[model samples]
Target: MTTTVRQILQKKNIQKIITVSPEQSILEALGLMAEKDISAVLVTEGERLVGIFTERDYARKVVLKGRTSKDTKVGELMTQNLLTVSPSHTVDDVMQIMTDNRFRHLPVVEKGVLMGIVTIGDAVKTVIDQQAETIKALSGYISGEMSI
Candidate 1:
């Protein structure tokens, strides 16, 4: 058995999630993000996943080409396709998916309902923490502080 994405689920009781209508201007999306201090917004339509808009999308699709955020609609600028995972998915499975797909964030859902977002950083931290504990255990054994 492997640890599920539920291990890395964002625990904060987020009442407000940054989101923009498909027809809304990208500029408006940016403003919402700035006000909410969020990195990405879950694009939804009355509780349906449509797409996602992230800062990377801005740099890669908009700003580099000098496209005006004010003129670009979110549906045009946002990544219409999305990669998603289930809360029951293992962290290791998520890590492999993220590494292979070059995804930084993944939305966790169960029964098609959005649960929370998990980032690559969170997975890496979990792995690092696990490694540190293993190292500590080994060091203790070598120092005769722990039994074999």
Candidate 2:
């Protein structure tokens, strides 16, 4: 059976989605990210996901441009042309997408509703866990402890 994004989200049990308004100051968004220990935050307008703000954006767009986070709006630096994924997508599918695009985070949406965010760390952990399970199952089968 393939592991789906829904399963990943269920396993993660994410309580709240951290988001910041487009009109908010970059400093405010950065503060929230710092407090949550996250490198990215979804930019929202009401219930609509407009863009994503990440550490990379801050480094390249703000810092390199000599822009101050306190004076800049998230909309000015956030990535607007986002690539989103649905819950039905497989773990492998998302892993490939993130890898090929060099993306560290992907937002999970279902019917245009933002569900949660998946970080590269989450994908790596899922793959590692899956491999461990497979190894254990193979070991059990070899030991005649379980039937295939």
Candidate 3:
């Protein structure tokens, strides 16, 4: 069976996206994130996906540099030229990309348009859930509850 990213979105039921301007200060972005209780925000110019700014970026870029977040723009530190996936792509494909790139977040794009983003945790959960189902099927077969 094929599981598309659209199916995952339908199941995940995510509704809102936190978006920020690239011109905004990292400090301002952090405050917005604290208020929203989200770990990452999509960097946008109008509706375009320019980059992603996450808590990890804050730690590595701002804190490590010893530069004041108030003085640092997200555009200067955000991850650029993002790796993206089509919404119609499979969960396996997403998992592969996330694993290979060692990235926690990925933007979903279609026809050069941004739709949404998925986290590494999301992809891993899907994989674990799928594995659980397989294990259950094997157990059922071993118990002769169904024909294999």
Candidate 4:
């Protein structure tokens, strides 16, 4: 069975997503991320996703540029051109997208509505679990044949 983002979310029981406004300072977003123990925050404006603020963005746009996080707005540094995936997208699809883009986070959306986000860690875990299950089944089949 192909695993979808919805299945992943259900399996993980993850429902909440940390979000911040574009007008908010980078420091504020960082604080939220730290509080939530997340790497990224969806930059929203009245339910509209405008961008995504992440540690990578901070390192590249603020710290490396000598810009103070407290004074810099998230909109200035957040990634606006987001590559999102739909909830119906299979795990393999997302993995490929993330691999090609060299990023960790992917926003799960449906009908332009943000649902959840998945990380590289999540995808890797799913793939590993699937492989382990397959191996177990194959081993069971081989053992049954040997015993017969």
- Against the true structure, whose lDDT is highest? 2
Worst 10 residues of 3 by lDDT: 1-10
Query: Candidate 4 regions off by >4 Å?
Result: 145-148
Estimate the TM-score of every prediction.
Answer: 0.82, 0.97, 0.88, 0.94
- Considering TM-score, where higher is better, how would the candidates rank from best to worst? 2, 4, 3, 1
What does candidate 3's lDDT look like per residue over 20-114, in tens digits?
A: 99999999999999998878889999878999999999999999989899999999999998888888888889988888988888888788777
lDDT of 2: 0.93
Best first by lDDT, ranked:
2, 4, 3, 1
lDDT of each: 0.80, 0.93, 0.86, 0.87
- The RMSD of every model to the true structure, in order and in angstroms, is 2.5, 0.8, 1.8, 2.2
Whole-model alpha-carbon lDDT for candidate 3 = 0.86
- As for candidate 1, its clashing pairs are none
The regions of model 1 sitting more than 4 angstroms off are 10-16, 144-148
Better lDDT candidate (1, 2): 2
Alpha carbon RMSD to native, model 1: 2.5
lDDT, candidate 2, 56-143, per-residue tens: 9999999999999999999988999789889998889989999999999999999999999888888888898889989999999999
lDDT string for model 4 (11-116, tens) is 8787576789888999999999998888999888887778888899999999999999999999889999799998888899989999999999998888988888
**Which candidate model has the greater TM-score, 1 or 4?**
4
Which 10-residue window in model 2 sums to the lowest lDDT?
A: 1-10
lDDT, residue 141, candidate 2: 98
lDDT, residue 14, model 3 = 74
